[model samples]
Structure formats: structure tokens, C-alpha cells
Target chain A: MSRRLAAALRPAAAIGCALAAMAIALALLGASPLAVAADLADGAFGNWIAFTDTLARATPLVFCGLAVAVAFHGALWNIGADGQLVVGALAAGALGPALAGAPHTLAIVAIIGAGGLAGALWGGLAGWLRARRNVNEVISTIMLNFIAAQLLSWAVHGPLMEPSGAFPASRKIAAAARLHLYFAPTRLNLAMLFAVALAAVCELGLFRTVPGFELRALGRNRRASAFFGLPIARLTVGAMALSGALAGCGGAVQISAITHRLYETISPGWGYEAIAVALVARLSPLGVVPAALLFGALDNGSQAMQRADGVPAQLVYVVQALVIIVMLAFDAAAGGGWRELLEGGAPDRPDATAETCDA
Target chain B: MLEAFAASTIAMATPLLLAALGELIVERAGVINIGIEGAMLAGAFAGVAVAHATGATLAGVAAAIGGGVAINAIFAFVAVNLAVNQVVAGTAIDLLAAGVTGMLYQRIYGATGRAFTVAPMRPIALGPLARLPLIGRALFDQSALVYLAFALVPAIAWTIGRSRFGLSLRAAGERPEAADALGLGVYRLRWIALLASGALSGLGGAYLTLAYADTFVEGISAGRGYVALAVVIVGRWNAWGVAAASLMFGAAIALQFVLQAAATAIPYQLFLALPYLLTVAVLALMGGQADAPSALGEPYIRA
Candidate 1:
């Protein structure tokens, strides 16, 4: 078989192996493997409502996934995306009510900008630390996530909290600021369209722009990029900040479109899950679209599986873990031959080695 | 007031010290095991489950080590062998552990609706040492884990600084290629370091369920693992440094609780956030010249 074909088949084989292993384990536990698969299908895409739910759920993943993908493409790891999302959502929640009497279009724009700017600022802090001080991004970002969570908790329960003193959540956003549902009888909103547009813009910026080339170059090798006169330090921080902004936008979308208010635990670690999504997509901005959807389907369906097949929703977490493991295993076994194909059969690959470093 | 604060601080610092020390060892050997959180979680669950099942705290401790080793083994294979991204692999392990433990807890105990409680490990007082003023009670009047954590600092310091094995481990982390050239098995040393870390981290987890909280709630580690990671950074990869950093963090955490109890005008959540905020500020001021092992976080593979 041709090398490219073999490369394409590797992931499929790994998935087959993973599923077979899971099936055997389930069977040993006295659960029908076939029944579980059928239930998963029924729960995720069994009906229009289910499909819409999956789409709605996938919305945040798409934003976060794209965020991670953009940063990963630049060879930066932005582990603080979760914290950025939280801060973004908080900004949107705080701003939404204050802009209640404003024109609908202006309020909506302000909310989105507030979320994106808040996320960017949060991300920018990490970037500044990394660029100016050479601090490890991973450790700093993770630490920031804790601070952000505590900050959010403090806000929701203290200053920004609803005066009624019910749950740990902010007052609801104004109707003018909320994103309208794109379709009737479903929670899917125009934010999905925005996500799609942003993903496309990221793709263009990564592959078509001169600055994108520089970012990709820096991602591939800091030394080489510096030699080529690319502002390596600046790019690293910028990539992370941009990545965080995307995640922050996702938080805003969740609050403005779905929840219509900021609540404690707005994300079930969507920022962290974005890492899995980005990795599974091989850190490609365009690839994140489908990868995020797959995660979305699993997440939306997990509850159904719990209710119907007596499986825990945590099973989705297991599946995600499995996907990352299998994907990495397949990617490693296939070698750079697959990566070359992933890079569109480019023989003179500039970023292949750096990409491997990223993985 | 001072006495109470000192006592609680010792209790809180024990787990962070144990976990941070474990992480320090692993990092010194050139591997960043982000799976400490997963290891701790597994230890917590296994420790509690075994304690409840066998009614022996000793067996629970043993089971916790075994569980931690099993989890680390998965990380070792994927990260060490497959050359996967260490951070991503570690994150996956964390998710996997969280998911599996949550499911198992539900499957085993969800039906009963009764809280699973075990006999807490009894504090071992050091007779004469326990009678001394504030220092004696805080240091001597504690469970075995607290004493072990304190002793571990000097023991680890001696091991890493003075022993031939420490030299070899340091050599491996500093330059795995050179270590390999010198006929030292880099992979084996790293593997051993990870397993040792697993044991200590597991003990830390057990401390949570068996000593600190005495019950298994979701996310019982409560970002302590991340704090441990920062402790390694702030400690600058030294055993004594880790101990000092852990105590600092522990004190910060304890002060939060004390302040919350005092119910001052300042919101309790602000106090809760103080440690993390301090960590970030310290890191920023310290300016990231951490001097981490050269090969730290990079998987070494034999060509």
C-alpha cells in the first residue's frame, strides 16, 4: 500500500483497537456493547432536537477548540484558555445589564467586544510574563486559571451577584444584549455562524497572511525565526493572547446566547477540553470545526446515555481521553509521512519538525 | 489565635509538602509529571475504598500507592515511549482519572445514599516532644503522614545532594544524551523517579481523604496538585525549598480558613484567592529563570 494511504488508515485502525478494547471491557461488565453503541447514536443524533442540542453544546467547544488550535498552530500552548473564558463571561455578564437601554445592535456588539477584550487581556498577562521573563506558559497559565475561578466566584457571590441572593450567579443580561436563536424551537444561535466565520478567518490568517507565516515560522523554531528576524517573543505572547481571546468569545457566546446570565461553573472545563479538541485536530484551525462537533456530539449525548443506558455522563470524558490517546498513538506510529500528508503533501516542510515538537 | 493557626497550618501543609516533594524528585530526574493530580485522585479513591473495605488504614495506604503506580504507569508508557506531549498526556490522565473515579463512586456508593466514612488515622504524639510549647504540638502532635512529610525534606535533601544515586539522577535530568553516553540508563532512572513520585503523591492524596477531609468528594484535591506544581517552581527544585514553599502556601490556605471563620468585612472568597494570586505575583517577580533540568518535560527516546 502507498505510504499516504497507510497513514490515513492508521487513525482508523487505532480507533478500531480502542473501541474493541472498550467493548471487551463493557462486555465483561455484563453490558451489551451493541446496545451501548445504539444508545450513543440515538442520544446524539437520534432526532432533530437531539441534533440541535448537540450543535448548541458544541458551540463553546468550537470557540475554545479554535482558540487552542490557533495557538498550537503558532507552536504555543495556552493552557489558561479556561480562565480566559471565565473572565470573558464575567465581563459580558457585568456589561450586559448596564447596556440594557442601549440600541440592540450596539449592546450586542459591546457585549461581544467586552468578552473578547476581557479574554484577550487575561491571555495577555500570561503572554507578557512569558515574553518578558521567560516563565513557562503552562505553569503560569494553570495558576491563572485558579485565580480566575476564585475571582469569578467572588464576583458572582459578592458585587455582581443578583440582589435576590438566590444562587451563585450574576443578574441576567438585558434582552437587547442577548444573541437570538437562529432557528425556531432550538437553542442554536447566530453565535455558531460567528464561530464558523472566526474559524475561517483564523484559517486565512494562518495560511495566507504574511504575519501568519512569521508566526508559523516562530512556532516551528524560535532560533530559526529569530535568525529570520521574526519577533519571536512578541509572536509567542500574541499567539497566546489571540488564542485566549477566542476562548473568551466562546464564554460570551455561552452566556449571551444560551444561559443569558453568568453563573458559577459556566464551563465544565471547556477550556481544558479545547486542548483535546486542538490536539485531535492536529492543531489545524480548519480541522477544529469537525473535531469540536465530534466532542459536542459526545458531550450532548453523554447525558442521554446516562439516562437511557445507565452509563454515566462521565463516559464522554473517558471517550475524549481515549480519542487523544489513540490519536497520538496513531500519529506517532505513522511518523512524519502522515504529517506530510496532513500538510498537503508538501515535501519541503518548514513546520513538520516543530509540529512534532508541539505534539 | 496564634496556636490554632499554627496547628491548622501544619495539618494543611503536610499534603502539599508530600506532593510537592514528589514532584520535585520527578522534575529533578527530567520529567514533568503533570499527572500528580490524577495520582492523588486515584490515591484518594483507592485509599478510602480499601479502608472502607478492609477497615485498615495501613492497607488503605498500601492500596493508595498501588493505585498511584498503576496510573503513573499509563503516563510513563504514553509519554516516555510514544513521545506524546507530556502536558497533553498528563491532562488526559487527569480527565480519565476524574471520569473513572466519578463513575466508580456512583456505581458503588450512589445507590446507598450513605456517606462513606472511614476511621481516620490517629495522631501519633511524640510524648516529650508533644509537650513543648506551640512548636511541639504543631510538629509532634500529628498523624504519621505529617511527620513523614517533615522528615522527607531532609531525607530527600540528603539523597539528591550527597548520594551516588542522586548524582546519576541529576546527570540524567541535566543531559539525558550525556547520561546515555556514559552508560547510565536514562529511561530506567526516569521511570523509577516517576514511580517514587507516584508513591509520595498517592500518600498526599490519602492524606486528603484519611486525614484532612475524611470523605471523598468530587475534586477533593481542590487544585492542591497545581499548587504543588507551583511549589516546585517557587522552591527552585530543591527539597528544602519545596518544603518551605509548601509551608508558605499551606499557611496562606490556613489563614484563609481562619479569616473566613473570623468573618471580617472582607469577603472570604478574596482570602480563598490570596494563595493563587500570591503565586502568580511571586512567579512574575521571580521572573522565570527557574533553572529547570535541561531535559525536563522532554521525553527521551533511544534511537
Candidate 2:
């Protein structure tokens, strides 16, 4: 088989296996897998409204998937994108209402920019720890995630609580800060388009730029990258900050277009879910769009499945997890190819030996 | 009030100690299972569901172990057999556990889940020791699981610090290739560590429902599993150190309830975020993996 065809088939096969396993689980639960599958398909793509809702659901995922891909490419294990997104939304939500007197376009830019900046700081903190303090990014990011969640909980209940204090939510942003829906009665908006544009930019930046090359090289072999004087610390911090900014912007867009206000739960684990998306796309920047859309459809459809078949919406999470597991297993079993790319060259490889010698 | 705080601290520390002990074993064998959280969640759900069905807490505890082992088994296959990235594999396991537990919980108990309570395990008082002043009941008069958690500290310390099996396990973690050369089966050692960790994590989860909360809730494990991971680190990869760190974190958590009840002007969220913030702060100060096993987090495939 052609390598390109093999590359394409691997993810498809993994998804197929994951769905099959879920089918067995559904059977055990006494729900007919076929019926559940049909319901999910119908709910996700049945009508124009459903399709638009899927798009809206996918918008944050696209941003998050990109964030994950960018960080992973630099071999930075950033598990705190969810926290970064939350802080970003908080920033946007806090600044949004104050932009009432500003021009509409300016208000939108400021809100998103604020979100991106906040996300960068959140992500940069982890990066700085890893670079300067030699702390594990995985642990720090996870801790940060818990901290960000508490911060959001505090914000909604305390400082950002709606004026009426009826709910644990912030006041809606000013009208000028909102991203206008392109079609009435549909959630279709410029945010999805912006997400797509960002994916294109990411694709270009990762493939066609010197910094991108440095990041990829760093990811492929950290010891070798350092030996080659690749400015390891700076690249690590920069990649993590950029990754956080992507997720943060996604949070900002969600506020601008969908929620319009901050709440205790601004993201439904989009940062974590994006890990599956990034993996399925094999960490390709451009591939994140379609991958996010697929997961988005699952999210949207699962609601309908719940209503029709008594299946819980959390079934999607199970599928997402399975996809990642199966993908990793398949790539590893296949030997070489994408596994090397994904793991950034295993230690036993020749390059690793060279790195050891250098050390 | 002071006695209550101490009691609460011990009770809270029990679960963290159990979970951290398991992680200590796994990390000592050269693998980090982020899925420890997932295992705990699986255990919590299984424990409550089984106990509720059979009206037997022991049965629930057994099921919790099985549930935890099952989740870790998937992680073991991917991270160990496939020789893939342990962190990513562990993350997937966590997601799987969360998804399966949440979906099944809703399916079995309904959306509102108002009927999901179980009779908590009765604390076992150590005869006359239970009546000795404030600290007595706080430490001695506790559930069998709580006592078991503390007892394992020395047991684990001796096993890892002095036993031949521990030497092999540490060998696997420190340098798998060298360990393999020395006739130690790195794969077997790592698998054993992961399985042991699974059981410990599951027991921790069971303690939440069967001994402490007396009910099951989605994400009741919260970030306890992750915190357990930090416990292993802050403990500096020593069993006794893990025990102390767990108690410190447990006290941090117990303080939340105490402070929240005091109703100070402080926002309750500040208290809620305390343990997590403390984890980051301590880790930052500790800095460097100077004491970490040499080959930790690396996938080793025999040549």
C-alpha cells in the first residue's frame, strides 16, 4: 500500500475499532448499537439547524486542537489547555461589557486579544517552570487545570456574578463585543470561519517557517536539539505560550459568539478532548479542522441519542478516549512511520544513541 | 472543633495515602500512570453500585479493585506492551474511566441520581485506644481501610527499600536495559507495579464511597489521583515520604471544610483551590528531578 494511503487508513481503522468496542458496550447496556448509531447520525446532520449547531460546537475544538498540536510538536506536554481557555474566557468576559462604547470591530478584537493574552500567561507559567525549574509539564499543567477551575468557580459566584445574582454566571457582554450570527435562528457565525482561517495559518506556520522547524526539531530529539544550540528554553516557553494563546482565543470566540457570558463551566473539557483530535489528525495543523468537526458532530449528536435511545451523552467521551488509545496502539504495532513522528523518535533509535553520546 | 479537624484530616488523608502508595510503586517501577485518577473513579462507581445492589460493602470493595485493575490493564497494554508513550496512554485511560463511569452512573441511577447513597463502613475502634483523648479517636478509631493504609507505609518501605523484589523493581525503573541485562524482567516488574497501583487506587476510590462520603458522585475522585502523583514526587519517591505528603495535603483539604464553616470574609473558592496551589508551589520550590529514577517515563523495548 502507498504510504499516503496507509497514513489515511490508520486513523479510519482506529475510529472503526473504537466504535465497534462502544457497540459491544452499548449491547451490554441493552441499547441496540445500530439504533444508537442511527440516532446519532440523524441528530448530527439531519437538518440545517443541527448542522449549524455542530459547526458551533466544533469552533472551540478547532482552536484547542491547534493548541494541542502546536505544543505536542514541540514535545511540550501541555495538559492545561482547558485552564488556559478558562482564564481567557474570564479575561474576555471581564473586559467585554466595558467595551460598550467602543467600535464593534475594536470590541471584538480587544475581547479575543485579552483572552489570548491571559491564556498565554497561564500556559507560560507552566513553560517557565519546565524550563527554569525543571518541573514536569504534565504535573504542573494538571495542577494548573484544577486551579483554573477553582478560579472560574470563584469568579462566577463572587466577582463576576450576574447583577440579579440568580445564577452562577457573569453578565452578558455588550452588544458590540458579540460576534453577530450570520443567519437568523442559526448559530452560524464568523467564529467558525475564523477558526478555519487560523487552522490554515497554523498549517503554514508549522510547515513553512524557521521557528516551526526549530520547534519540530526540538520535539524530535530534545538532547540533540540542545546539542545543536537550538535555544531549547526559549523554544519551549514560546511554543507553550503560543499553544495557550490558541486555546485562549477559542475561549474568547466561544464567549463572543455562543455563550456571550462567563459561567462556572465555560469549556466542557475541550482542552482534553482536543488531545484526541490532535492525535487522530496525527498532529497535523490543517488536519485539526476536519478532526474537530468529527468530534463536534459526536458531541452534538450524542444529545439527540440521549433523548431518543436513553444513551448518555458521555458516550462520546468514551469514544474519544478509545480513539486515542487505539490510534497509539495501531501506530506502535505498525512499527516506525507515524509512531516515531508522534513519540518524537524512540530512545533506541540511532539519533537517540547520538544524543546519548553528546550528553 | 480542634479534635474534629484532626479527625477530618486523618479521614481525608486515608484515601490520598492509599492512592499515593500505589503511584509510588508504579513510578518506582519506571511508569507514571496518570490514569490513576481513572482507576479511582472506576473503583468509586463500581464500589457504590455493587454495594448498593448486594447490600455488602466487601463485595463493593472487591468490585472496585476489579474495576481499577481493568482500567489499568488497558493502560498496561498500551504503555507496556505496545511500548508507547506512558503519559498519553494514561491520559486515555483516565478519559475512558471518566466516560464509562459517568455514562453508566447516569444510565443506572438516572439523571437526578437522588437515590445513590450507601451505608458507610462503620469505623472500627481499637478497643480502649479509641477513648484516649482527642488524638485517639482521630487516629486509632477509624475504618479498617484507614488503618490498612497507614500499616502499608512501613510494609511498602521495607519492601522497596530492602527486599530483593524491590531491588529488581528499582532496577527496572532506574535503567531497564541494564536491569534486563542483569536478568530482571523489566516488563514483568512494571506490570506488577501497575497492577499493585491499580488495587491501591481502587481501594482509595472505595474509601470515598464506602468509608467517607457514603455515596457516589461523578468525578468524586476529582484531582486526587493527580495529587497522588505529586505526593509520590514531593515524597521524593519514598513510601514514608508519600505518607507524610498525603497527610499534609489531607490537612490542606480538611482545612477547607473548617474554614468554610467558620464563614470568614474569605471567598470559599480560595479554600477550595488551596491544595492545588500548594502542589504547584511545593513542586516549584523542590525543583529538579535530582532524585527521580534515571529511566522514568521512557518506553523500553528489548533489542
Best by lDDT: 2
Docking class of 2: medium
Tell me the deviation in Å of residue B197 in model 1. 0.7
lDDT of 2 by residue, A247-275 (tens): 99999999999999998888899999999
lDDT of 1 by residue, A132-168 (tens): 7666677778888888898899889988999898889
TM-score of chain A of each: 0.90, 0.95
* Clash-forming residue pairs, model 1: none
Question: TM-scores for all candidates?
Answer: 0.94, 0.97
For B1-303, candidate 2 gives per-residue lDDT tens digits of 888999999998999999999999988888878999999999989999999999999999999898888888888888988888777788889999999999988988897666667888999999999888889889989998999999999999999999999999999988899999998999989999998888999999999989999998889999999999888889999999999999999999999999999988899989989999989998899887767777777888888
- What TM-score does candidate 2 get on C-alpha atoms? 0.97
List candidate 2 segments past 4 Å from native: A344-359
Indicate which candidate wins on DockQ.
2
True contacts kept of 1: 0.53
Q: What are the DockQ scores of the candidates, in order?
A: 0.44, 0.56
